[model samples]
Target chain A: MEFCATWTCPGPDGPIHEHAAAFDRGRERRVLIVPALFEEQNRTRRLLVETMRRLDAAGLDSFLPDLPGCNESPQDFAHQSLHAWRRAMADATAQFAATQVLAVRGGALVFPAHLPGHVLEPVKGASLLRHLLRARVISGREAGEQLTIEGLLDQGREHGLILAGYRFNPAMIAGLEGALPAHEGQRTILLSELGGGAALWTRAEPGEDAAQAAALARIVAA
Target chain B: MSALASDDTDDRLRAILRDVLGLNADTVASFDADTALFGAIPELDSMAVAGLLTEIEDRFGIVIDDDDIDGEVLETYGNLLAFTAARLG
Candidate 1:
């Protein structure tokens, strides 16, 4: 329903509890939703949550957990990396006893690959990084500051750079540059398959499509 | 590289615009070569341009150089389509 539940993940120092939105009715089919990363997370939360609602209506239970540094979590976003997120998700899977996963957008990069489920519009970590860098470049241009993707990436790798208001550490930058979504044992669901005009993640603001959500739930529930 | 049809590029570009800008089907279908983008559409702000470029690259399977992009390239629907068609060719 809401953040009425918490899942324990191994933190850098010790085990940490993170807020999770769950639709649990003790259904036989439980889906762990790995939401889109970064700004895309905000852009697609409603769509994912709507989809979860439909899944629940279809007699499926689902859990949408926050990444350690995201949402209501007390962790610092800058200190997070792909490795840490993957571990956190893996722990989420175990703790929730999720039978299937629903990795959306960049979440594909960190979803537990060992489980069979669905990946919606999976994107490479490099692409995600490029999108962020390009946004920074565009904003820089508008502000009369010349910034190149290559230059920003170099700086990010050496130290850390704030892209689109997100402070990323060197490890996070490096990890994102090479992270690719795992495909084995997962069904790739493209936007086309969902019969949607465009993915919510691409929009400048967050929006939702009820038809798209229903289509996704039907696919997952089927 | 094999060339892509001009009509195909036009359709794909329109689709990208519709998806990226969240334009309705009628609005996208009504887009002509002279249809202004960027400043004309409020949704096509600087942030959206980033996503638009990345989606164009992904759909068209061509890498876009940052130096090659400018206001001129995104001035109109025609200009963007022509540029993508040129890259495909």
Candidate 2:
């Protein structure tokens, strides 16, 4: 079952309340799930939720927290930064008392180092930005916007640019472009189709792969 | 015909193709140098290309500079394998 919870963290404006969903097993072993960013998050949310259920079944508690300006959070995306998100993840870890982390894609950029966990498909910020730019360019062309990704990126640097319905500030873009996946723990899981059906995040719409969730649950439990 | 890679490099490239493209084992097993990749396979889109490059770099311990990416490098299964094998050398 999904239990909604919130974590308050200091932000540039004031206190930001970040929402999280806790998959409760009433047990002590807990895992915090840091999700992929932007559209990727929407695409993989179902798999993450399913994995949380599997974790609950395996007698493990899991928490999926939304960073500022994401999910149910009302914070402005324009004000969000990698630094603030890193802090948010840390706060969630302490608030939920999580002992392990399960991060996917760009989430690895902000993963807490002290906790032992699995990181799947860890990506660099520059690589992520490139992909995001490609997507925006393609969509822009389809919409007849006559916008180039280079132009958009330059505009973002000058002020902010809205990509795929999400507004990105210059600071956030710079922070994300410089961020790289960080994990000191030995347990790292690369992308595979063994437990997952495919890379659902590449799909155009929200997708789910139960096998992927099962694979993730098994790894985290192990 | 082009130069052939060692059985090991060929095997690893095949596995990488299967894993990154999410292809079935049978499909990957039958694939050869002549097999078209980027444009032929619908799943090998721009986004999938990023995932493929990241996976290749991770599994093969290679660093694919942005300049290394081009139409010729990703043209076929053979082209990708040779690029990777050359990197390994």
Candidate 3:
């Protein structure tokens, strides 16, 4: 049972629109899924979609809410901040009355502290930023441009620079660089893969891993 | 672990390559101890390297320092298995 859902978040400027793919059973044990950051989010989208489908089969409802300025939201990425994204997640949890959360990759960075949930492949913001910067450099070189991490950050500081196809504002860059996920949460599960599979996010194209998605659903359902 | 045990470990590592690196099962199935990773596989670039390390750390319950990462550790299937086994031991 899938449906499109929307939640309104009170942003500093005005109301922010948040969108989601909901797997609803109207059951008591609903889980909110917070996906990975930026490029990772797009890469892991299929998995999240599949996970939601499987979760419905497993008799548990879940919501895959898009962070503000991402996915189908009307908000602009140029102004999106780590704190706003975090608040949006919390808002989704409350709007859905979700009891648990399942965070993927850098999603843990924005996961609410009070909600009990599972974390899959938790990553620090600094590490994520470093990888993004590396990819930006590679792409820049491939495009015959001499782009450096320092230079990119400097540009971002002045105005939002599009890096790896995502706009990173000065505030967003600074917040993401320094932001760390709070460990004092109701975190109950930690899931990571053990075998050889490509990191889909780094791929030039989007890819899917049914096996990985199935494994995650099974863990969350348990 | 005996030679046979080491062989088993190698097989498992290959599966990890297939799962975490998102390599095709058939492609990874042909990989042996001599199969070059890291620089050899196009998917195993800098970003994938970080993902691979995180996957390895989580799966094996071992911590890998950023400084410890060099070209040698991920050179081949055997090298990765040996590195993991050493940390496990």
Candidate 4:
């Protein structure tokens, strides 16, 4: 569990160094893991880390990088756009010399399309945005304020509204509205394929499933 | 919808609830039409409802309008299953 500087993002100040959770021993098969975005990232982090450990035991090296606005990065979450994240991922892929890629959920939207790998449960950006908007609406109802998804989206498009606690800029919201996971050279692994009860990304809270982790690792290893 | 199709929707809805709420297989299997959902189940919070609706749309290949959503729709297990079946039609 080494925290190593994996890539650099061009910042207003200067080049910003970004770190990653790396399980590297200079193995032959190196994989760059592009994680799910926002709140889903939190729910699936433990599962991804567990999978990384399994991959390590199987003699494979993996690196899960912190995107510009995520994790330990110094960048503002509201300032991050999908385009910037894509560039950051491309930088990580090159810096790590990743031989393959493993994109999880919304991660597929930004993963380097040239690299051949696997995409687990690839989701459309529209769906991701809808989830966030719906959550905000539900929360508003609880607070005795009426809110609608369309109404919130309209607001988000102009001034950028906070959804599910994440500050999303107009560019980020617009980018997400049209983002879709690339599937050309990647194998799409569905939840049914993993034989899981339900995906951790959809869970109400952060949870771990060793069986699910092992299933994913096995697919990646094989 | 045919009887077979309705049964399929019922099964899928159950599976979605189990997966989204992190409910056990047996617990979900035992859920009947009368079982309360949104209020009764601790795991099925408002946030979970968002994920649940998304999953339902994805799995059933149905687009659910926000106007169609209401407390009554999600009040019981049977209501959700029936709503999903109607969408699939």
Candidate 5:
């Protein structure tokens, strides 16, 4: 598979540029990956690369774009919003015929409002965090020290902090906070301690089972 | 009993917050149980809010049902702490 260098996408403001790669095979699924936010993007980079490679070997052509304002892209930090980022991904997805657009981590939340043939992957953003927390714990980290979503409010406690990249604005945060996942912790959550954070949400666990089968089991068996 | 609970809760909360927001220990040291969050810090967005909840559930071994609360509860630092304590207790 021949991977191209960086490229640009058409945008209303200007060209939404990114570190672009493209590979062609015998008419396989065309996929686009919306990367995670802030530093999570860095930690998950290797897993993502491997995922793209797997897709390539599976004969699926895919596009992984460094959204504007991130990595080697053109959008400035302050100007990057969920809406604009969604648009950039939308533009890339439209280029595909019947290819699937899959998003990982926080990027999952940025899926287009009308997701046609979009594979959410494992789950959504909130569950990704939950899975990540577990992955880190099970891999061996201090069980007592992981951070969480509701715990972030800190009403009784003030002046807590953590290091992060990306300028996360309120509108974006509000939208994110509103989403609640069907499930949180998984096998990775328990073993996450030894593994740090990356081993969770993004780490590929191979198990084939039909989602519809599980749901129907509840209804049909019941 | 009061002092022990206070110390433990404060320490636990500080560590949790520090890790969640990517804040340094010193920054959390300056925080009490009553600081404003949400608009106060640019990083505390809805996405972070949701991520924070997942972390809390995993670390504290608590189950925060999808229907337990809404995003507004996470809009401030103090509110979040109270919510956690309530659930933990």
Candidate 6:
């Protein structure tokens, strides 16, 4: 009944790592999903489960794949780039919906390049930032430090995206700014409260769902 | 919607922005609803965005999630004011 799992698949470059969840394979016509970032992927783990259940009961499937650089899927985190991650998601989509998809939060920045239309969730760049701040806070680092975009660009490029010595592509710095995640799930917004993003995080699994049905009501009603 | 109509909040938001982004400027103007923030602002990266949200939460005493008007309202100084107006209530 629970729908979350991790797997490895042949990628355009090499063995690609992925995470999948079936919202409802048999009855659902659409799949709501996304590929989130490092800490976010871990923080939303539990909430993703709850969200999948909600989608499954509603007869939909949600597929979440760990991006190239994230999770312990035997992939090179340093080699992970935006394009590779996009391709990975595209591959995951081939396995899920033959056609439709939906994603929330930062996932909205990515959608089918060829899809007829997309449904954006309420999540935005700022939302992703919130999750990252929480990550800093939990790490016992001063969450109060106001790290800037320019600063990241400078630092990320200077060291070529090293997170405590982990190699992240410098390009990812700019990509984060331009990410306008799109989805097929009828433009909705997801909010979190106490431990909301806990699930996606390796250390904490979020227990709160800050999303309201009213956000996408207009889209559904239209 | 009207630049948050509060001199106090405006000044506070500037301070937060400067603190979060590590700026030495005493003031920043042109924060409107249509202002493009995602890519235009040099300091407003994903990490800074998170820091800004946390700062707002502590300052305004409100919980912000992705679903909230953060992304849209935060596009510019004006949008932030609008968001602050709504949250201040």
Judged by TM-score, which candidate is best?
1
**Candidate numbers sorted by TM-score from highest down:** 1, 4, 3, 2, 6, 5
Candidate 6 per-residue lDDT, tens place, A1-222, comes to 445656565665767656665544555355545644565555555555565556555555556566665664567776666666666667666665535554545555654554432343335554454355343332222334554434554676656644423565666645654565554435444333222222222222223343523222222223
TM-score of 5: 0.48
Error of 5 at A11 (Å): 5.6
Q: What would the per-residue lDDT of candidate 1 be over residues A60-113, giving only the tens digit for each residue?
A: 999999998998887889889999999999999998899999999889999999
**Which lDDT tens digits does candidate 5 get at residues A1-222?**
567545556555767556655555636566666666655666555455555566665666766777767777766655555666777777766754425555554665565435433322324444443443333332221234444434542311243222243444544444444553222221111212223322223212211223322221222112
Clashes of each: 0, 3, 18, 0, 56, 36
Better of 3 and 5 by TM-score: 3
Better of 4 and 5 by DockQ: 4
Question: Cα lDDT for residue B63, model 2?
Answer: 83
- Give the alpha carbon lDDT tens digit for every residue of B1-89 in model 3: 23423666666666677765667789988876677986688877655666666666766788875545556777887677778777777
What proportion of the true contacts does each candidate reproduce?
0.59, 0.04, 0.15, 0.63, 0.00, 0.09
Q: Which stretches of candidate 1 lie over 4 Å from their true place?
A: A1-3, A12-14, B1-8, B26-36
Which regions of candidate 4 deviate over 4 angstroms? A1-6, B1-9, B29-34, B85-89
Clashes of 1: 0
- The true-versus-predicted C-alpha distance at residue A97 of model 4, in Å, is 2.0
Residue-wise lDDT of candidate 2 within B1-89, one digit each (tens)? 23767888788777766665667789998988889987788877656666677667866898876446667777888888888888888
Q: On residues B1-89, what C-alpha lDDT tens digit does candidate 1 reach at each position?
A: 12333676777887888887878889999877788987899888777999999889988899999878777888887788778888887
DockQ of 2: 0.10
Q: lDDT per residue, candidate 4, B27-54, as tens digits?
A: 9999887789888999877789899998
> How much is the lDDT of residue A23 in candidate 3?
80
Looking at model 6, residue A65 earns an lDDT score of 64
iRMS value of model 1? 1.3
TM-score of 4: 0.88
Candidate with the larger DockQ of 1 and 5: 1
Q: Give TM per candidate.
A: 0.89, 0.71, 0.72, 0.88, 0.48, 0.54
Q: Which stretches of candidate 2 lie over 4 Å from their true place?
A: A143-146, B1-89
Fnat of model 3, as a fraction: 0.15
Tell me the RMSD of model 3 versus the true structure. Answer: 5.6
